[model samples]
Target: MMSNSKEIYESITTKTIVAEINLSCNDEQIDSISLTSEDLQNTIRIEAESSNSTNESYCSNIIEESEYKPDVPTEFVPVVNSVFKSLNLAVKMYNDYAEMSDYKVKKFFELHNHPLESIEERPYTKKARKMSYFEKEFVVHASKAKMGPTMAHKIRAVLKGGYEYVRVKVTDYKNLRRGVNIILCYKDAQIMINKMNDRRDHYPNYSFEFLRDGDMLAVMFWADEREKAFYAEFREVISFDVTFRTNKYKMVFVLFTTVDHHKKSVTVGAGLLSRETTESYEWLINAFLSAHKGKAPKVILTDQDPTIKQAVESVLPNSRHRLCMWHIMRKLQANVTDDLLKNKDFKKRFNKLVWNMHIKPDEFEKKWELIINEFNLEDKRWFNDMFELHDKWIHAYFSDTRMSALMKTTSRSESMNSFFNTYSQFGNLLLHFMMNYDTSIQKQRNTQKELDHLTKKAIYKFISPRPIEKTCCKSLYKYIVL
Candidate 1:
């Protein structure tokens, strides 16, 4: 009976191995293969017997087991004759079945090979960096408020709790601002022109003129209603001067400034020109006159630029053009010898002669001639040229002109330029420049209004009991009550 059972078990095992190989061979074409209860019983019996077999017999059983293929493939396969089952065969079989069933296997990685960023540092990463609508609006408003990008970012960081919560770097803010400026630059000229037109339409006294060079803005001049009124009231002593490069295009900023009733620097009109040529200056002067109803100032003070002199001569021939005494005096050191400048006696006398408001032109000439003779500077070209143009700069020559004493220099214009520099930037687009200009002008007007209020409300005790003093205090501005 035992011999018969062994023969039966061996025969069953051999049959099971043969069936498994045959099933695997047909696995590519079959949908699936199922085993009967008898086959499962036979497999269990074979595994039990293999556990009790001798070492050599177990090794032989393992060899046979490795050679036997399963009906369905698995990820782990036994080696056959030192060669493992081909993964491509299993993959191809899976692919064919997947194609027939319209199915796909998608791979996903849940673990990363590299170290991950901490939560605090994640916001600064490129993937996490972004500007929201509110953040962008804040940045734009900050820019309009004259805040720089880094400052704006800092403010935003504070508002958002911290820099980590801001979700963007300072460079991102700068890049966004730069991009916005670039977009604005494309429409700057047209937008400025449109704004001017709109202002002109709304305010009848608001005036603006522009010259174009091949569709590009070359020159622009503008004066609001308040500025026009300022020009009308304080038009006697105008100081015109060009500021250093104040815009992106490297255009010259020509400001027409004057002293108001409060003796504060007032910008009556302003212009931007591509070039500082005579023609450009003439156009600007003409525009200024046109903006103010062609009411030329009685006396205009400016630095001694030949182009400006020619422009004034051609445009405002009736108006007296006086060179700025301050500018000429500033040039004294450069034009004169150190020996004469070092002479305290010569410096005192020269300054006294040049600044003497009460001196007659003949006396000024005689004193100047004596100084030149004493300094042995008769051969100095700058001195000779300045002497020849003495009538334009010397206080004695043009002092008789009405309101000429109000402005002996272009200092008002210089102050106005410095004031505007606070509001405007060299990299501003034309539209931004105009906006900053409007902001500055509005500030100036506000200050003027404040002064006007003070003049009207404030009372001063009479320092001297004189009718003229009382009358002047009541009539003139408080600042002019000297």
Candidate 2:
């Protein structure tokens, strides 16, 4: 019975040592314990004392004292001494932990030394001014209206004297702006959902489709009543282009556009896609075509992205596809030397070869071969590919077709891109982008209406009085003397 009790006493003592080490060593000291188990054991032996004795405290007194002095001599077995020198390291680690905890405790009390100001009252000691509930409501409404914090804060200061509200600094508003944006994210999404649900009344025949990948919205295509009407009126030629990172969602903004009679760009359809894959392009194109009653345009102009090209071909098999001449010409400058572009003779020759209206297909081939060999660009892949795909954009091929809108390039689409860039900022909320787009489209249609009125009612000055010219002039509403 005595031996069993001794064993139990030893077990209890071991547990007491473990508890003491745990109470003494802090989170920072845990890494030290992991590295050196022998040091940990030594620490436990030195720190843990008999719990059944008259002294009942377990590490409370030692923690308060902070200073730890070793009881034994340092000189011992050299090999064992070398290994257990980590016990001193463990002591240093505990010291740092204790110092940090004490500093934190001091700072915690120091921060609370001054009492918090009441929400209804301003600071009493200083000439402290606080924004009133009315001012806060105005700032929040301004933020929801998409006014920047600096401007909102300035407006708040301007209204302080007239009302009883106190003026707050821009610095105070800066902190509130971040929380406001987080709230606006979900608020704006819910607002868009409401609009999308009730769009049938305001935008008849409007269509919208969305795909979601788990919780995140993946792709969406939308066409309003105006877009559908524009497509039906002028669907002969269309330019398809996609702009990236135009909204807060980092979505790819796709637009289908065409030129009005006055040569101004008009949007036919618009979409936002989450990815640049072939599947997304296909879905967007399908949605766009379905919205327009699947009436394919005679000619579709675009860049040389293979996925978009393939999607267009698959969706609209009957439409003739054409690459943008300006995009192809950009590659011409990029692939060639700067000196060649600057050289007067080379520049003149290159422009004539690219833009000459009188050059036949055989003549074009002859001139192209000569230019390639003269410029030592025969081995260039870009030059060779343009040569192979000459039928798509080399004006001579499609100039005879009356249905072709003669829009061999996507320059108008590029113009639309720049126009939208001015109104729609990067990382803008999706709903804000759509709202700005409404204003932009309205401006375009208004300009077109003015131009149409001018074309119908205005007269033109004639250069000559020849009978053929007079007869030609009599057949038309009005003509501009070029």
Best by TM-score: 1
What is the C-alpha lDDT profile of model 1 across 111-184, one tens digit per residue? Answer: 21122234455566565677888778887777665688999999988987887777888998899989988788
Kindly give the number of clashing pairs for every candidate. 0, 0
What's the CA RMSD for each of the models? 18.4, 18.6
Cα shift from native, residue 339, model 1 (Å): 1.7
Off by over 4 Å in 1: 1-134, 158-168, 463-482
- C-alpha lDDT of all candidate models, in order: 0.74, 0.66
Error of 2 at 99 (Å): 60
- Model 2 TM-score, all chains together: 0.62
Best candidate, lDDT-wise? 1
Candidate 1: residue 440 lDDT (0-100) = 84
Q: Distance from true position, residue 359, model 1, in Å? A: 2.0
My TM-score estimates for the predictions, one after another, are 0.70, 0.62
